[model samples]
Target: MATRCCIAGGGPAGLVLGYLLARSGVPVVVLEKHDDFLRDFRGDTIHPSTLQVLEDVGLLDRFLRLPHQEIGELTADVFGEVVVMADFRHLPAPRPFLVLVPQWDFLDFIADEARKFPHFELRMGARVTRVLEEDGRVAGVEVSQRGDTQEIRAGLVVAADGRHTTVRTSAGLPTTDYGAPIDVLWFHLPRTPEDPSRTGGTMRPGSMLVTLNRDTYWQCAYVIPKGSLEALRARGLPAFRRSVAEISGFLGDVVDRIASWDDVKLLSVQVSRMPRWWRDGLLCIGDAAHAMSPIGGVGINLAIQDAVAAANLLAAPLREGRLLPAHLEAVQRRREWPTRVTQRMQIALQDALLSPLLARTDVPAGVPLPVRLLQRLPLLRRLPARAIGMGVRPERVRLPPAG
Candidate 1:
């Protein structure tokens, strides 16, 4: 198979890029290893900026029609006192809130939309195993579907395969760790009508539990130090449930539902980025290029931003058959600054707050000074809300639908 762009890993990055380029009348193929898009990806926060991207692409209305919970304000339980931290109500955005939808649903929506474009093809169960290269530049990929392995040649091969991206590794692109000191234990707790109406975090003396309102349940995350999953599991299931219940006692009744350790999933959080996102015919985007910490649930949004940016910058060149290595480098140059700034913020949040806070076993005090201020001064809350809801240098749709 051959095309203008062959994308590996049909996650947010690949799907969005494929849709944009194909909509612009460029031949594009996205290879997704899984036959289905059903999986529990922890980060599901879609910010208002991403909604704007959808609006630009004529998808926001239809997307909003889907079932999703809106988080207009983020409230954190600090020292057992619940305080509103960031409020999106006043943000200058198309939608002034975060949408909590399963990642699979969001991906499927885009996939369905992309299928309408004549030049776009999404191959589920096609796992890219190798990067095809010519003269030291990426030319395409080797994708295995069912029992057949096929060579796909393209003008460009995008490695959106994710943090453990095979294409980037096969291409031997070097990455630098920005340092991460935590991981998360994810599980779910049944929700009742009596529980709080909004989604937020529970900060304990030495532990942190973040929850997303999944409508009928709370998708919970318990943050702990890096490489501590084994020790946590060794503590025994009963003990682990007790610890989770103790930390997030609000879900006391549902704690028993976590019956065994198998109910919990561990995500080894990573905060790092490739020094450069592209080389020759290959360009890495999303988690493949920059893995984000689950700090503010911003990773997915950042990945979507990268897709929009890449599409905006590369669609015309890809369509015109004038693609160059410089075009790939331009994507890195455009996105690197925002990636750096976001990672710095995550690192600072971890070191100054989470790391020290998670190491404790007793209650500290009221909310953090900054959060307390946001609670007291409701108007001032828009600052952090703007930061989280809009992000840095949000991208707009540049390619109109192919007519």
Candidate 2:
């Protein structure tokens, strides 16, 4: 197959780029390994930065119609008290809120929108095994899908495959590790009218349980030490539920829903970024370029921001058949700083806050004095809201919206 651009692993980055490039009348094919977007435990929060991108492309009105939960402020419970950690309500943007919609729905909406453009093709279940290189430049991808193997040829190839990306790793791209001391065990719990009014959860000794309102149910993430999944599983589901209940009594009733260890999904957190996101004909975007810590839930928005920046910088070049290594380099240069700044904040939060608390043996009555100041002072919350909600450098739609 021949295309102007062939994108590997269709997550937020690939889909957004494919949609944007196709709107410029550039041929694009986005290859997703999954047969469907029903994969669970993915980043579901769409920040205001991403919401503005949709608005710029004129898709916000239609996209907002999808069922989602909106959070104007982020709160964290310390001991027994609720603290307002960050506020998005004061953000200087059209959508000053974070929408918690199922990731599958968002991806499907982007894919379906992309398909409406004549030049876009989304190949579901198409697993990219390796990048096609010719004379030290990326030619395209080698894909295996449903027992069939084929090669896709393109002027430029994008790797939006995510953290465990095959395209970048297959090409031997080096990543600088920032190190993460925590991993998350994610699971779902039943939501009831009798539950606490607060949406967030608590961090007590040895455990941190975060309950996000996913509309139908509570999507929970229990944080644990790095490389502790085996020891945790050995302790069994009952102990896991006990730790959850110990953190927040509202979850005591629904701990029974965790029938087995299989019900708990483990997310090994890593914070890292590539020194160089592009080489020759190929470029890396989203989690493939930078694996973010799950602290602020900013990974999805960051990935989407990368997509918009890349499309804005390279769409004309791809459409005009003048795509070059310089174009790819420009994208990496444009996005690397924001990725660095965000990852730094996440790592600092983990090291300075979560690590100290998790290492303790006794439960504290309240959080540290610095955190208390953050909660008590209304001005302090906007700092994080700007960083997390709008990000360091938010991109506008430089190209025309797809019809």
- Highest-scoring model, lDDT: 2
Name the regions of candidate 1 deviating beyond 4 angstroms. Answer: none
Task: State TM-scores per candidate.
Answer: 0.98, 0.98
Task: Write model 1 residue lDDT over 339-381, tens digit each, in one string.
Answer: 9998999899999998898787766555677877887889888
Model 1: per-residue Cα lDDT at residue 172: 93
Residue pairs of candidate 1 with colliding backbone atoms: none
In model 2, which range of ten residues has the least summed lDDT? 196-205
lDDT of 2 by residue, 1-403 (tens): 8999999978888899899999878889999998999989999999999999998888998999999888998888887678888889999888899999999999999999988989999999999999988998889889999999999999998999999999999888999998999999999999888776555657777678888997668999999999989988788778878888888888899899999988889999999999999988999999999999988889998999999999999988898899889999999889998888888889999998889877888877667797799977989999988998999989998997544
Once fitted onto the true fold, the runs of candidate 2 whose alpha carbons sit more than 4 angstroms away are: none
Q: What is the model-wide C-alpha lDDT for candidate 2? A: 0.89
Q: What is the lDDT of residue 209 in candidate 1?
A: 86
